[model samples]
Target: MNETTLPPDDFHCGYVALIGAPNAGKSTLMNALLGAKISIVTAKPQTTRKRVLGFYTGDTHQIIFIDTPGLIRPKYILQQSMVTAAHSAIAEADAICVLIDGARALERGDLLPVGLLDLLRKAGSPVFAVITKSDLVADKKQLLPMMARLLEFYDFKAVIPISAPEGQGLDGLIDELRAVLPVGPQLYPEDMLSDAPERFFVSEIIREKIFEQYRQEVPYATEVFIAEFREEEKCDHIAAEIIVERESQKRILIGSGGDALKAIGIAARKDIEAFLGRKVFLELHVRVRDGWRDNEAWVRRLGY
Candidate 1:
């Protein structure tokens, strides 16, 4: 590791779960802290579906970072599972990171963090608040009130203001995390990066591209599933299915002469290659699976 990313002590190690409302930049923060893209990120809310683990190894400590789904009230069985997974991380974690967007302010967004903090306090978990996107908003004065907003419900061990995308206040956040880490042996190997398999990441890459290219409910209704993964002597080949609910959504995804699908494939292929550090042949198929999100059994089968 470089001097800039160095951890405080060689002997500190612990599980720090990243918890927050939707689109609070937790995944971006985890990727930045680890100095790698261990978690996938997108503009849409609830981009993360499970407890993705990103292992960051320092000279002495290995921080097992858990990237959780954004906390929201469940409207369907899949959403309920997501919310459960989010809370499970908080319950099991040695330390908790409640991330929020500093530039957006607190009032405009959903206050799910308020309820989440109550659960954390009741469980006696040490909590820290990280206000993300600090670089977007110029007024530093808003930070005090933002911190106060969080403090009103529950006392945090530390409150860090950061722009995860711009890399602001990351040092302070890491320093605070290091101080809270318990003395223990590294949980994962030094070279090991993430717990998610290649297939899972492939699906996420496609989904991220959908979120980037599509608008509104189209992104929310879509889910990517890997149908085939094969390796040739020359290159790695992958076939993935993009599931949507309606035929109209299918038309939008495929576009004229399959242009839209091609764009998503190209973008996703680039990311897949970078993640695998090898040449990749990405093929995408868009299909309509009506009401898949609302169906509990289908959601579980799709690995959501």
Candidate 2:
């Protein structure tokens, strides 16, 4: 008797890295593409501190979108490392998406320090210049000059404008991505959305909550470390410590009667539960790291 076997999964897979300046909505774009909050988004510069991977699967394509930290000047060691991570993503990607906020234009003082055009030229990757926040800019006339100026930077393989918030031009962006993806086996399973482990997600969730609650430099000065994560059938309990520079900052983070900490915990737990699809018990604590952001050792230990 002859038996017929199923055909192999001939999926198109490739890595596409998103690079942009701070507050360029790269995280929002990634979340929108994945149809989930795979990466946290807030109305603050430098909200994302590490490289986040988001997966997009279609009938015949699996595009792994790497959401990197917004590029900026490196004032601290941590910031330098974050910038390095973004550049590494650019080098490793099968394709590159250079995201620019449409509402903002390059000015005399405003510049992308790494010389993105040159970097792209060196990497030799097919780059898509994506102007995000299309919904904000109403008049196309206002954007035309900006687009033209962008063209002067480099000859992009494709230039597309998208509103990640309103989900505009996403299909076209996806189609453009599909056209550029090399034919290969799937890099990740259809069900997987990120390359990070649960512990990393736990820390990020807590950090996101902290960013939402704090103002000024508090959020920027803060880092979340998952000291311990214990999983139970009933609940996945996480013990995380928020590292800060000074005792005053620590007090502020803790808040009166731990109200601020409670707020952060409550918010983080809710997001964590949604992310893991299970109950989450979150414990938060504040510690003084004495300018840990500039400390290379601390940055590595915190997994910058």
Candidate 3:
């Protein structure tokens, strides 16, 4: 192995799970910390349905951040799997960061779900409370009460306020997390950002566009699968399938004269090319799977 791949003597490396409500900024924080977009982000809730691993390699430590799906009461097989993934990350992580939307907490006066608190209490690893979207809080003084409230519920290793968009309090968050990590060799190469394959991200990119392009149930009902990815001499060839639960949803996706599908394709192709750093020929096909979210077999087949 080369020098970059070899771990330093005092390197600290461990997994830190980021768990929170949907759209609470877990993916945003991970993307900011890694300086790359490994997890997809959208304005809609439950945008992330799987655990995304992002590697933040510093000279002294490599923090493997597990960006998990939002914590929720599952009503279907797919949601159950998503919650399971989040819980599994908590059990396996060296540390856990529970992110709460600062503005939303101020509005609702709730810091966390009772079940989530119970899970953290039982978790063997150290837990930290992170207040995301700090910039959205117009009155900075309100953060004090929110932080105090979180401390009353659990003995968080640290309570930090951060805004991923403005680059606020990120360095301090990193320092605190790094300090808690166990001293060991780097788990991944220094230059590596994530362990997930390229196809996963390519599919995610297409899914993100779907979420952005559609509203309400359409985005939630949709799932993208990359069936073919072949690297060519001058470009790459990719074929993807977009799965929906009903024919009406598929029709909505395709639109009149296939205009909507074409629009989604055009938008997704641009991002795919940018992410892959090569020209791409992306083909998308919509198919109805009939209540796949509630079917355990279909959920597993979709890699949920």
Report the lDDT tens digits of candidate 2 across residue range 89-111.
Answer: 99999999998888775333242
Pairs of colliding residues, candidate 1: 10-60
| Model 1 local distance difference test score | 0.85
Best by TM-score: 3
How well does model 2 score by local distance difference test? 0.85
Candidate 1, backbone clash total? 1
For candidate 1, give the lDDT of residue 206. 86
Give the least accurate 10-residue stretch of model 1, judged by summed lDDT. Answer: 1-10
Error of 1 at 38 (Å): 1.8
**TM-score: the better of candidates 2 and 3:** 3
> Clashing residue pairs, candidate 2?
none
Q: After superposition on all CA atoms, what RMSD does each candidate show versus the true structure?
A: 4.0, 3.1, 1.6
User: TM-scores, in order shown?
Assistant: 0.92, 0.93, 0.97
Q: Candidate 3 — which residues are off by over 4 angstroms?
A: 1-9
Q: What's the ranking of the predictions by lDDT, best on top? A: 3, 2, 1
Question: What ranking emerges by TM-score with the best candidate at the front?
Answer: 3, 2, 1
**Residue-wise C-alpha lDDT for candidate 3, range 1-304, written one tens digit per residue:** 3556665667788999999998889999999989999999998889899999999998888899999999999999899999999999998999999999999999988789659987887787999999999999999998998898889999999999999999998999899999999988877887889999999999999999999999888998989999999999988999999999999999999999999999999999999899889999999999999999999899999898
